[model samples]
Target chain A: MTGPLGALRASAVLAIAALATLLQVSLAPHLAWRGVGPDLALLVVVAAGLAWGAHSGLLLGFGAGVVLDLVPPADHLVGRWALALMVVGYVAGRVRADLRPDRRPALGTIVATAAACSFVGTSVFALSGLVLGDATTGVGGLLGVILASVVWDVALAVLLVPVLLRALARLEPEHAR
Target chain B: MTVLDLRPRSPEPPERPGRPGPGGRDDARRPREGRRRPVRLPRPATGRGWGDDREPTPPRSLVVALVLAAASLMALDAAGALAPVRGAVAAVAGPAESAVSAVARPLTAAPDWVRSQGALRDDVARLRSENDALRGRLAAAPYASNRLREYDGLSRLTGRLGYAVVPAHVVGIGPAQSFADTVTLDAGSAAGLRPDLTVVNAQGLVGRVLSVTRSTATVLLVTDADSVVGGRVGTTMDVGTLRGRGEVGPHGLLDLELVDRDATPARDDAVVTWGSQGRGPYVAGVPIGRVTKVVSSVRETAQRAEIEPYVDFGALDLVGVVVPDGTRGDRGVIEADGTLVPGEAR
Candidate 1:
């Protein structure tokens, strides 16, 4: 991938990732489900990973995760999501790209992936908080977060993933075609 | 045929002269006995076997480096080493969040506005009905209070009480869901408000001023768990410590403890503030509540009872703070410490 088209693709990916991360931070409170909201940032990373390959997935995941850590009301230690989302992105990217367009994984798979991402993301956050000497953030709260966020994320992914995949396809570079 | 051979296979194209085949069979198999490891791949030949050539594996070295960097950042953040960095990020993100809020505000408000219009009409009708009821109450108020004052000798007592009362409006309420029982009053030091001053309404004792700023004062409600007032039972004058129960109700309960075990004050007995010596946090003879129940035991040294406060702490709107008479009248002067003296006040 090179030249002006490649530049446009890169910009589009970055813009989408940045906008999604910001929206997750800003609008999540209003859409809260018992103190948790769908991690739209994680969804964006998974979409980027599934559309592109591992290298692009890891990059976008790290960038969005770091932005999420820095945002206000984010009281946890930085890089927790960076690590978790990076792994999620890498794993999601591993799904066979050789399949025919019509032979892609079913909706169940996407929903499962969303739930898994929510679980992994929350576990990392809680474990990191424990290591950081935050004794009060107990496992019960983490479990609640996982339960609430997974349902919300799965719902969001159902609506968001296909649109994101289409947008990514539109931005595919000439050589990638 | 072997199972591997029986598996359906996609056709493979011939490899370029120098470039290896897409499968990189040699890469999957161990390096030849004497050959050195290739510089292109970061890992040794024992790396996790083979991924599909079509789906690129992220460089292990890059992934390791990125993960290590992130871990280091987490450690630094946990150790509070990244405080300044976080502050800088927040500084940039705050305005961005504000802009997002501006855009989302209308969208969020639209549904609320539509719902509230119907609610507003209902509220208006309800308030109109309440206004008529209140008008009737107002017509009867002067006569009732006058009769009560005469009946209870309240005016005679209040005249002797000598405290200046400053009227204040309740402007805000602390979150009801929270544990801290407090309210914000519009009156402050400028209005002769001070910490430890008593706050009350027509009904009875409200609370004491906890802190006072130039324009606002925080009043700790009598219903707070920590609040305690000296109270005397009506007629019997059985003095006891009136402690707040912090109950959940419009008029929270108070527990009057340390009463003389022999003093059997009947239910519905009125209780009033026993007054501080220097006209302190509680002034003498302000009605506190009525005895709801009395709990007594032979083994217990002192009797206890629940008193239902006359003032509805949850529904406070207007209240008065007790100050010195000097602050209340022009003829009396206020001292540097806010104590009212005999001289004329400015």
Candidate 2:
């Protein structure tokens, strides 16, 4: 019973991850504010890390990050996102043990995870900008991006994370048996 | 107890004195097999909570994070240093965008279909109303005979000037932001257009061709900051420099600076091209506009007058590109031959 349930959980997680990638690429552009769009991939990485342990979280983050690097508007060096997401996933996984099993704790975990992911992602972009000799990456624009991403991510967390967490909990084998 | 005794107990095998029997060997193997060795994994304790009560992390949080990151990256790259990455992403995203567009096409058509039905009925009523208004205006227009006379003078001048007129369409308007106060024309090299060709409408001189491509050309309107035209005030033969002061809505104002400091410019004086020694792009005696104001100052070298152009540039649908007669060279030979005395040829 345990073995079969574990396999089902893994497959379910993978499917959700794939779906998240698809949505990030296809739907995120339309929601841009002043030409700034939200980052769905970062949200997915943070969630994966919180759900699974550190090792699985790192693997998931790396895989999704690679797919994103391959997808549109190839502007940056390919491995930049991979490295950034790996760190984010690892951090989220480490924090999982500290979170309580109640509803409020789950919400708090998601909010915190989103904030951290946003900060890391923005910093990576800023560093890449500096490395590439782009003069427009001023302090003001960087701040604006960070603020916008955090607000957008937090809103998404509040609205969508609860429903997703409930669905995942339902899929657990112990509950099913 | 009596029933148990009646059951014959097979004689127990005599215990071996020194060496173990086959049954002892089987008994020895059973304990080893039953006590299975635990697999020596690197982190054995980590697997203990495999079926624990911890909930799976919400996918939405990760999705939100990814979206935020992607958007930030795109914005940064768009305004910052990741131009090459932006291009590559745009290339890969193109097909996905097209697919989405294809799916959304039908959804977008519904609004247009509804709007078209409403517009068709309104258009028919508008046409009927416009026809009635135009008929009334036509009847009233004949009463303004003096204005018609002025138009007749312009038509007669065009006919007698022998200027090769190539009709062109206006493909663009001014305030292009890049080339302020300039317009793009549909006619270009393919239409026999060349740089410095004089462009005009029925009213008067418009501007000159600045640049030309195979299918299009940019016209530097007389009202552009960079444009300077050699113009004269009416029959006074007062020469001046006509400079553009950008555009003011539909009408562009020209600053006419008198060549002679003492030359007095009267309001409503007709401004015409003061042709140079075959160097002026526009022909001599073509009307430009009317003087609106005279600006004279103590420190200024020459008095300046503001001229309101005769052409309604905003409504200009068709224009004439003046191809000077002598430009073709063959016309000059034909003219010289036509002027020869018949008896002197022998």
- Misplaced by over 4 Å in model 1 are A1-11, A96-106, A134-136, A175-177, B1-54, B110-129, B138-346
Question: How far in Å is the alpha carbon of B270 misplaced in model 1?
Answer: 55
Of the true interface contacts, each candidate retains a share of 0.37, 0.09
User: Lowest summed lDDT over 10 consecutive residues: which window, candidate 1 chain A?
Assistant: A96-105
Off by over 4 Å in 2: A1-15, A102-108, A128-136, B1-346
lDDT of 2 by residue, A9-50 (tens): 656765675456555655555565675666776777777566
Find the candidate with the highest lDDT and give its number.
1
Model 1 sits at an interface RMSD, in angstroms, of 8.8
* Residues B166-270, model 1: lDDT tens digits: 656789887768765789998788776789999876678889999999779999888888899999997798899988877655667899885677887789999
Clashes of each: 2, 33
Return the lDDT, model 2, position A136: 68
